[model samples]
Target chain A: MKPTSLLLPLLLACCPTEACEGLVIERAWIREAPPGARVMAGYAELRNDGASTLVVDAVESSGYFDHVMIHETLLEEGRARMVPRDTLEIPPGATLSLAPGGLHLMLMQPVSDLALGAEVPLTLRCGEAVTETRFPVSAAAP
Target chain B: MASTDRSALILLVLVAVLAFALGIHFARRTAPEAGAPVEGMLWPDPPRLESFTLDGADGKPLTEATLRGKWSLLFFGFTHCPDVCPTTLATLRETVKLLEETPDFAQQGQVVLVSVDPARDTPEALAGYVGHFDRNFLAATAPPDRLAALTGQLGILHTRVPLGSGEEYSVDHTASILLIGPGLERLAIFSAPHAAPELAAKIGQIIQFLQDSP
Candidate 1:
């Protein structure tokens, strides 16, 4: 069932999936990292704009980092595991979010220094019409 | 937005009570002579817990009773950790959520984030930062000398370094999750790659054993 009106405010503030209608990415950001740390995480909401379902197989970015893959964080017996997703799909007019403490993107092998405020250019490949986006690396979420 | 406090406190006491009983159970010399005794395996025996009274979020007294009769996961970290602290804490929150959904999985322990970067992580800052993950988490810190003594005995480590920002700095420290059981003993431990379900399962089984014993 679609979330109720009670969720409208949150959806707008957080996901904004409806606002982006027709397959859009809303508010993608790289949660800040520690000095000299190799791994970093990304979060976003992918909203499907049409009546048809959409499958996002892979993502690409330019001049920031090369490899970006979908992964989910799970804790089993006190150990954290990162499970990779071959692809993520969203139903018609639905938004799928890559959030902290759950499914997210692991951006590894940075091509250059990801200074604060630098936007990582991204390309989300969903079939032929790829949607482009940017994720600004900012201070750790408050 | 839910409270992990009252329920967690209740569960913690229940677990701790059960654990104390287990501590006694393990201490007895045995091979049941006349009775069909309850069956169990000791994954590992726990270490004797020492008592401590220290300051908490408010510069008030916090003591060994602070952990009495409850299983607590204590993590030594600082607020400045841009990655591990938050990530690990969030994982603990998820782990707690997973336990809640488990059938009869009693939430007997608390997740305590103690700031090793005491110079910067004032109790208020520590509390605020940890509350961002889950409200019930205990965010505590003490003076550098005392903090060093407590953490050192626990095998936790911390060291400060100069950041390129001239006066500003950063700290590197040991990041291990310590499991404190009832009777205040340090129980089974977990390293990085903190697995939630498996950890919960083991703790659940431990709790069950603690509950079953007289």
Candidate 2:
């Protein structure tokens, strides 16, 4: 979705975080990681259905991995460096992309083997409201 | 007096010539850079790592013996790296051809690649990948731990990062080429922005120097 206009807020009021009762999490997913590595990245399109702006700074996953952090990758002087992003902002109706080779969340220290075709439970906590989603670990596209 | 002055002059000339030859030999060992000699920057006393045994793509054991008595160009990467890995391999292939044009490059050594991603990079996959660049270049990989150990010893980095589908991700790694000498000891390292002609000339020069050395 290009993420523009909305009769969306009315529909999302159904599921809102306890702390902040206005914003709603639309969708989230695990992009896809190189096999054999314990770490994985996640992205979400969090929509603020409320009147005020919402800032999301923390995320967590409990299926197998726990250490989740927001980060960005930058390529400078022919070198790639990863840095943390303070908070993710949702100004009412906008969507953010935590895509490949760019801004994303880090899922570290896998507790067990998270195989393909499996779902990883994720929680995005901004303010008080925590939205939950099941992110699927996709196989490399054929 | 005449004999002494004449001998002194001859000795000075011989010393100057010898120094010049040594200079040329070392100079050729350096890769030519952009519009300049790559020897412009030479890593001093490049480390020679202890050798280890690993299996080639054929599932046959490959060790230091395979690297003997030849000027070998060693690279570490995986088959899945379609972008950076392939580009570097192609460049190295060109480097091989450039040296071959020198008429005796093969008399020096061979070019080979060792897969860092051991799990997916089977001997068969490696053979296919390396063959895409050049058939003679050997490809090898063993266990994941062995792959990690070799890369660690050689200073390569491959870390998996998270992607959003919850468990999907990618690996961030260092892409550099390693030069292995006749004794299977690491001779030098080549970093990013590898230039073919320069590398070819430098490798050719190193081979020549090794050939002439005792």
Candidate 3:
């Protein structure tokens, strides 16, 4: 019945979660794969503005692809190998780049055709916070 | 008079010695050094690839003979690979374009992409994947056991990592591109982080060195 309590509930309802407010995705793109290609890779930069570290646990793009997983390319002994990553942690006030030959998203079993210049919706999940973003399908980088 | 003659003789001997030394130095300088090695990590004796068979994009049998008569740039990767694989192929495409620009180098070499994931990369799929990069690009794949015979000889490494649940999995493979000589011999291994122009120049230098050598 208190005015402050009512205000608090209203604020909480208005802003259900602020966890992803500090997470920004820049230059997001999914490499346009060849026809009949089953897999593609997505690249982007994730910037965290909050005071605490943010962890990206999973990526999902339904209907367009079967699933999306985080993967990193490791160069060792003059060889490059891709390793699946369970979680990617972005330090507070820092930007984590997911570029070619580094950290990227392995998109698998595309359900439909993906053309260049088309935008694909992607969802990033970390803990209880979920962020929605769209990535443009671009030509594979040289 | 005899002492004067002796001094003249000594001067003649000194002149002869100096002339001989100068001749030797000029000969050594003008003559090409034996085994003037190429710039890359050229194997003193290039290793011949073991006999193996795989399906080419055109459905023809890819064997040692397929690689004969021309230089080949071979890369072992999966079509699913996004970052390293495509970037490398694109770089190679540019490299090939550069190579083609050189006189007599055009059509003297080919770029091949060997699929490490045969389960998913059928010949048709590979054709589509490789053709996307360059219409002339060739793609091939073989069963795991057959692939081992070739990869083992080349010391190429690849491993499969499961992507959790379902039958989906990803392959981690060596990113180095193997240079195969015209004789089907393994010439050099170009490591990753490859630059198109630099790699093309290195390849040209090596090829020129080989052609110029006896």
Instruction: Report the lDDT tens digits of candidate 1 across residue range B1-214.
Output: 2577878888999999999999878767464565756443454556655665556875565566888777777887776554456667767877777777544444566888888777777777766677767888887888887676567667776667553335544456665687777677776566655557866776677667766876
lDDT of 3 by residue, A1-142 (tens): 7798799678767886544657999989998888877778899999998888999999989779988889898888867777889998999999999988899998888998798888899999887688988999987532
Error of 1 at A103 (Å): 18
**Model 3 spans > 4 angstroms off:** A1-19, A140-142, B1-40
Provide the TM-score of the second chain in candidate 3. Answer: 0.79
RMSD in Å for candidate 1, one decimal?
A: 20.2
Q: Scored by CA lDDT, what does every candidate get?
A: 0.69, 0.67, 0.85
Per residue, candidate 2 scores C-alpha lDDT tens digits across B176-203 of: 6778876666777776657788788777
Q: How many steric clashes between backbone atoms does each model show?
A: 22, 29, 0
Which candidate number has the best TM-score?
3
Highest lDDT model number: 3
TM-score per model over all chains: 0.51, 0.49, 0.80
lDDT of 2 by residue, A1-142 (tens): 5454454665466765465435565445564433444456665556677777788877877767857878776544433346667788878666566654467677776677566667788777776567667777653211
- Residues B32-140, candidate 3: write the lDDT tens digits: 8979765467766888887898988899988888888888999999987778998888889889999986554577788999999898888889998999889999889
**Pick by lDDT: 1 or 3, better one:** 3
DockQ of 1: 0.06
